[model samples]
Target: MAAMATWFLIVIYLAFISLGLPDSLLGAAWPVMRPDLGAPLEAAGMLAMIVAGGTIVSSLASGRLIDKLGTGPITLISCLMTAAALLGFSFAPSLLWFALLAIPLGLGAGAVDAALNHYVATHYEAHHMSWLHCFWGVGATGGPLLISYFIKEHDSWRAGYTAVAIIQVALVTILLATLPLWKKVAAQRSMLRASSRPHHSDASVKGSNKFTAKTDREEDIRPSAQPMRLPGVKMSMLAFLFYCGVETLVGLWGASFLVGARGIPAETAAWWISLYYGGITIGRLITGFITLKVSNRILILVGPLISALGAVLLLLPLPGAITLAGFVLIGFGFAPVYPGLIHETPVRFGRANSAKLIGYQMAVAYTGTTFLPPLFGLLASQAGIGLFPVVSLLLIVLMLLCSEYVNRAIKRKYLIA
Candidate 1:
């Protein structure tokens, strides 16, 4: 049983890692698509926002669906839908069609995000959960590199996406094969629920055969206690929103900042983007290990401050090496925030509400991820690309404030020293 559980987790992690491929390709392919489609920079930015918007809507809806329907159906549906949407995107003829297709792509991605997150939160240990995100980081980094290779070969970005669509189809097949494992966990949960009910009378406890299947059914009909509400679930939700904003801002716009603001070549900008994700990948692994030894408050409070400093350095007229260092630092500093928040969510809220809480958190975060960066793009267009770092600096400062709030909440809840 223990080995089976471990194998189940491995499958879940693979499914999640696979999900990041599309997002990575989308980010890397933007520069090529913009020129091909005669899109303005803002239109390029809008492509990202449209996909994120779909994710936002679907994440919120998936939470309720997961609670009512369980993870198997949701995961299967999401994987199939995401595959179909990617196929649609691969064949899109115009910018308008591509943008429209992003909606279903986002929905499929969002559903997978919500369901997988819920599954891990409910079944996995905390340390393992952190490591699960590491797989996502791996996928995020690999996606861009693959796209870069195709772009170098003068291949169509459409072909790159077609390849991803095929991979998604295989992922769906693997996930379907693993459906029975999740059902076993669900059955265990149901048995646990049945065994925990109260006895009607003292006599019932003394092997009274009168307390039979009918009596058990009567007790099962009663509502269970509401899941334990985290003391600061609302505040944590807000922190997640800010974290998402920062993550998306860096991932989506950081390359543009390099190209438009710093005058780096498009190819160079894409490489730098990979470094940003690479930093995240390294940081998440390191932070996950660090988290096992350290408390959340220290990491939460200190990480953003380090990232804010990195953002400040990037804003300056530094040398290329120094600017690259800034991106690395920003990546490292921002790395632990997301996984840490996810690790804490299940600890704070009981497993029953984990999906809904994470859904709400992602929905709010996607709002910032989807909307704010385009506004930043417009700002850059108006004020100049040099303002990009300055804008990021301000967001980092806001993130610092949010981190402090989270720190205080952790202390109040006795989650930290």
Candidate 2:
């Protein structure tokens, strides 16, 4: 059983890598792809919006979907769906087909992301949650590298898409073969939950999460929590909104900000921005190890301070090396936040509620990705790119406030318990 569990986790890590594989391809290949399809450069934004829309919609619905289909089936189906989309993209004749393919691509990604995150949070150690996400970072970072290499080697964006598609298809085969492991593991998990159900004391039962208020104590009143119908739900959503928004904003505009405000060369800015992402990837690896010794609470609370420091550096008229370090610091600081929040979900709320809440978190995260950067873009157009650091700082502060408040509420049992 232990060996089966390990194998299942390894496969899940690969699935996460596949989940990220197609994501960066569209952005990286768009420059060369657009002309072939007779599309304007600006059309990339529209396609991106379409993809984000699909992802958001799917993430919102993933809880029910996974509840019905089971995690293994959902993951396999989503991966297959994503692979099919990439295959279509490889041969897409026009921007229209690309847009059409983007829908399934987005939907596939959302389901896989939500399912695996919730599953890992419920089934594995906190450190595994951090490590699995680190694997995702690997995939996200690898996608662009693959695209670049394929484009350079074959001089066709189609080649890159095809290569990624093949990789996904191969992964799907491995997933199919591992179906028995998922079944056995899932059965074991069910038994474990059953065994643990009777072990809770009165204090724990206060947080039992009936989904409807039945307890005499439920009348004690968390007036604000009633609307969301869950304790900590609102704050969790807000935290996701700000964190993902900030993440998107930084990645989208970091280079532009460096060029515009810091007087860095465009090429140099791009290089440094790549390192920012690399910092995230590397930092998550370190965070996984850190999780072995440190609690998620400390990591979650401390991470934003580091990010804020990075933002302050960006705001300062720092020298060249310091400016670069600021970006890296932000990336490293952000590394543990998203995954830490995820790993803590089952802890904060009951396991029965974690799936739906995580689905909501995923949806909100995508919404932030979908809307925040563009809105900030509009503001930057008027206020100047120098507002980058200011905006980033504000977003981080909001996220940190939400996180800290939720933690306090949980501690006080002031949340929906």
Candidate 3:
């Protein structure tokens, strides 16, 4: 069973790769793609907004879908949808086509993300959750590199999209093949949990239907049926909102902060931002090992505090080297927070509610990803980018406070650790 679950983890990692592949392809290829489609470069922002909107909607609706269809079918279908969308992107002759394709692409990506996070959180160890997300970072980083290679060598962004689309197709095939692994593992987990508790965690396939069957009339989807009014739920949303806000703010403004405040070159600042993402990747790798020993609550609480230190480092009147190191510190600190929070949702909220709350958490996280950085940008424009570290520190503090509050609320009311 462990071995089967481990193999399933590998498949999930591949799906995460597919998830990451489409994400940066648009950004990297948009420069060349825009001219070919006769679209303005700024239209990328419009397409991005469209994609984000689709993702937000998809995430918000994932709980119902996952409950009915199961994670395996959701994974398979989501990957297939994304694969088709990406292939369509390769053939899109106009920005309008790209806009249309972005919808399914975003929806597919969100379903995969939300379903897989909840699946891993409920089924696997804390370390696996951290590693699962690290795979996402791997995918995110690989997309740009893959697209850049096609542009540099073939001089065609279309070829790049085709190449990535082909990869997504391959992952879809793998997902289709491994549908039973998800079923098998989930069945085992459900039985074990049933033995230990009284019919909790209905993350299994409902009554022998292989793929997508319209099975409704089951009341197992809701743990409480009213999780929205819970203090822990609200606090979790607030924490994710602030946490993701801090992360995206750093990514969007790191170079700007260096250039505006520290008088650094754009090229050099880009290198430092690379270091920042590198810190996140490497830090997640280390965090995988760290979670073996530490609890998610500790990881979540400490992550922001460490990020606060990084923000402090940026705010100090330090040397350029130290300021650059601050970005790495921030990235390292951020590494464990998101995954830790996701993994703890089941423990804090209970497994029966994991799907729904995780969906909410992811939706709010994406909402933060969508809006917070830009909101901070508005503030930065008014006050100058010198407020970079200052605002980051403030957001980190809010994230930490909300996260800690949720932890305590769960412990007090739910008797959860």
Best by lDDT: 2
Candidate 1: tens digits of C-alpha lDDT, residues 261-283: 78886666677777777787888
The sequence of per-residue lDDT tens digits that candidate 3 reaches over residues 1-417 is 667777878998888877766765664555456568997534655676667678898877788999999999998899889889988988988888998998998899888888887788667655677788787767655665666566667777777778877888888888888787787898886676666744221222212112112112222343777877765789889999888778766865766677668887544555566566667777788888776666667777777777899999999999998997888889889999898787666556655666677777888888876776666666766777798899899999999998888766655653331
Number of the top TM-score candidate: 1
Provide the global lDDT of candidate 2 against the true structure: 0.75
For model 2, the stretches where C-alpha displacement exceeds 4 angstroms are: 26-45, 90-95, 150-158, 189-232, 253-274, 313-324, 346-355, 377-390, 410-417
Q: lDDT, candidate 1, residue 9?
A: 77
Which residue pairs in model 2 clash with each other?
231-416
Question: Residue 350 lDDT in model 2?
Answer: 47
**Better model by TM-score, 1 or 3?**
1
Q: What ordering of candidates by lDDT runs from best to worst? A: 2, 3, 1
Question: Which scores greater on TM-score, model 1 or model 2?
Answer: 1
Give each model's whole-structure lDDT.
0.71, 0.75, 0.74
